[model samples]
Target: MIDDELRARLESLGGLDAGPGSLAGVVVIDVTRVVAGPYCSMILADLGATVIKVEHPDDPDYTRTFPPMLERDGADAFSGFFAQYNRNKLGVTLNLRHPEGKVALERLVAQADVLVENFRPGTMDRLGLGHERLREVNPRLVYAALSGYGQSGPYRGRPAYDNSAQATGGLWSMNGPAGGPPTRVGTIIGDLAASLYGVIGVLAAVRHAERTGEGQLVDVSQQDSVLTLTENAVVSYTTEGIVPEPLGNQHPFVRPYELFACQDGFVFFGGYTDKFWKISCEIFGAPGEFDDNPDLQTMGARFDDAVYAERVKPMVERWFSGRTKAELEALAGDLVPLSGVKDIAEVVADPQIAARDMVVDAEYAGYGSLRTFGSPVKLDRTPPRARGIAPDTGEHTAAIFRDLLGYTPEEIEELRAAGTI
Candidate 1:
């Protein structure tokens, strides 16, 4: 049964917005760091979970030390990496080696709904905080483990980062310009994909826990996430016996899908369907040239680059180059899936980006105002909102200790004196 008060709180953004963000009242223990684990926790935090970051006393999240830090009075207060991923969360430090610290974390786990970690396969077990032990304490706690490889595999114990996952996964094998060297995707898709998968798995596990009071382990591999993205390439090689190669900017299964040169810049066209292709042909002043030809008329036939390049590329290129980007957009933007290639400057200044709140200003005391990307998912009832700037390291330690653990001031001081927190 839904608690009306809690429901009201979740449905109203705690008086901040139209609705309380989804996942309100959910408690998340974020023991993860860097991209995969931290980014996942970040998403959960964005959805209004109470994410408490658990950092090792000796060596906390290195993201805190990353470059491009926020300086206050000539001292680094926070890094851009930390600010980006650790917002809407509390920060705390604990030495798991200490019995008191370990006990405190176990208590936190017993009360938490989710726990996210991204260590090597056996690290948590060695630390006595493995999923099995934690589940024994709280059966309904969702435990998500993210790693470069899976929790059980030949490469499970090996350390890996974004670049390693990208190189090992099929993404690097299939990415890059056609017939060129293997090129890495510009973004850190390996880590980002792992975070997305982890989020999905966590949500599912949490739902399961709610129904059955039985938590489960969610194991996400960065390599597997990256490999999942090479679906088309893998299918081509395994099923059709065709070795895939990278084709620069051109669609593997569609004709006239690549960027074409215009007078001022480049324009992209994804008019892959029959009607779209016909429209494109008419726009290129080659109306009847491809309408009757099966090779150009059908999508699969157009996948053949030789036919497309010989029959269609020159004509489209000539037509595109004859017009400026603005002229081409005026002529065809609404007719087809088309856009002029935009540089970073143009993207930042794009009105569509602004209208969608993709770019917004976030103000911090030391940082003043920084432009950041807003949440992409928009819920009709509970829209996501940035709570505030990220807290300094262990900034909420005293409050969390006093409120959550019922620790008296003396106990808190003792723990701090003993280096247990």
Candidate 2:
């Protein structure tokens, strides 16, 4: 039971007073860990799903140990990394390897709308709680499986991580500067992309189940998701037989549509279109030169490698070298698509981010009010939000077992003693 002070603290969180979210009545059983699966369930939780995140009693989610860790009187209190992706969810502990634990999971599945997991392809089946078995418990359940590779592929059983997915998905080969070594993306795009695809699949499957009363597996693979995100590379190679290489910050088809050095920092400019190019020329005080020089007249003419190297590139470099990012933004940000690159500190302080509700304050257990990213999705009436603080390990175990599973206090004690909770 929550004490009055703790209850009040939770009630004062960012989204608790927002009435109902988009998925108000949905229930999600999250058996995932780390980044990919938890991130997917977190989005569902943000959208008002009652998500119960289950981990083993002895082995909780690994991210719980990740930094930046909070401390209350020098003891480990909370993990900011975990909190970022796991807010707005209930937490429970159950050992699926135990027979009673498996039975408890089946009971939960009987009443759940969706179940998500990110294990090796057949790990759930090995535990005798695979989608096939759970469908017997609830025929309308949407079972989403996120893995390194899809369930049917040859590499499905192989263990993989974000770097592995990037390497295998063809994104690594095309990410770095021209003629440079293959570079992994700065962030975990492979896992993030898979998580989003998993969310999309779950929502669509839930809708199908609601309408047809039949549920199917939603299989999402990190490698496949990352491959799908390799914009134009696959098609360009397939159709034109042109091997794509990293162009650093340049767009392959659009000349001058890349980052340029400013006096202070870098700014990305998209003055590649015909209209924008002319406007850019006017802004650079070279409208007459642009009109008179046939080589820089059309986007096509400027796209030629020799013409760009000889004429257009040096001119843009000279003009941009004289201005700061702020000055360039002030001159051309609204006229053309341009933005001064911002670090995280600057991003959180940006007025547009504040107005759009892209930054929010979340109250952690020991750390009073810390910042976490807000949800990007915005619905007119029922928008998404970081609904609550991340739960401690098995924080709601007793309440969930008593209320949802109809377990007596005596049985709860027995399960706890058996280490099956």
Candidate 3:
């Protein structure tokens, strides 16, 4: 039964609508935090699912206190970064380590359509809340697990972060400059990629359940997910017996496919096809150069010619140096693809981002209004809204217990005293 306190909390967020379903009836139990799992669940919530995020009462998500903490309107200021990833979901605190907490969780699972957890391999089983256990209670529950390594590998129990996954998954080796040490990507690429894959798996499972009334387990590994993004690098090494290293910003087998300096900053230029290369030469008034040397005449030949790179570098630099990034972009137009490398600030303030409503206003009761990234996906009939500020630890304890879980005032106090809610 839904507790009155929980119901009150939901009411504060505009009570859950129970009408004809359109993802509106789906309930997502979010037992994961940090980047990947939270990101995946947020996508589900954006699509109109009711997501209840369960965090530990005492050791609430560490992200809540991440840098740039603000003190606002009587409540502790939440980290902006934390708020960004956690929007569009309801927050509740539960000490899953306790028996009472476990019982409460079972209650939640009974009504949930999907449950996402990112605990290490075997952790859920240890808690008796693994996929098999949950399926026993709710046969139609889609239990999705996200981990660093897979559930049954030799490395299954090993802990991993984004950098570790990048290293182990072969992404770092092919990322940086040719002579530089293997470098992890600037962002949590592995985590984000894994989250996306998890979402795909969950959605697929959800559809299958809707059709056949059968739910299944979704096991996603960050290592495995990131390997997919490595593309041909893995295959090249396996098929050709060549261990690939970083090629800097250049494509391993493509000539003129790298970033070049202009008079101002930098511009990435790639003319992959022979026809495009011919056009590039013509644009730079170097058509004769494309025709003269047999090695420079074809794509494959140009790719293998180290000396040819030196010969062409100066010309490429000179042509780019004469124009501003905007001018160069205009000159290339649809004929050639060119982009000005932008930093985060520039990306945030970009006209395209603004026009697409990629940044939105989120109202925190204490903070007034805060800006965060809007949903990246668009739905014709169900657009997502930034619902509310991330809840303070245990802020909704009384509300969730009294409203949604149907607990009485006495029971709430008893649980609080017992340190179980």
Total clashing pairs in model 1 = 5
Top candidate on lDDT is 2
TM-score winner between candidates 1 and 2: 2
Error of 1 at 249 (Å): 1.8
The whole-model lDDT of each prediction reads 0.80, 0.86, 0.78
Where model 3 places Cα greater than 4 Å from the true spot, the runs are 1-22, 286-297, 386-388
For candidate 3, which ten residues in a row score worst on lDDT?
Answer: 13-22
Task: Give per-residue CA lDDT, model 1, range 206-253, as digits (tens).
Answer: 999889988999999999999888868777888898766777887777
Tens-place lDDT per residue, model 3, 264-333, is 7888888657887777777765558666655665767666656547765565777788777778777774
Q: Superpose all Cα atoms of candidate 3 onto the true structure and report the RMSD in Å to 1 decimal.
A: 3.3
Q: How many Å off is the CA of 67 in candidate 2?
A: 1.5
What C-alpha lDDT does candidate 2 achieve relative to the native structure? 0.86
Give me the runs in candidate 2 sitting further than 4 Å from their true place: 1-18
lDDT tens per residue, model 2, 171-196: 99988998888789999999999999
TM-score of each: 0.91, 0.95, 0.90
Cα-lDDT of candidate 3:
0.78
- Candidate 1 vs candidate 3: which has greater lDDT? 1
Query: Candidate 3: deviation at residue 270, Å?
Result: 1.6
Per-residue error for 38 in candidate 3, Å, reads: 1.0
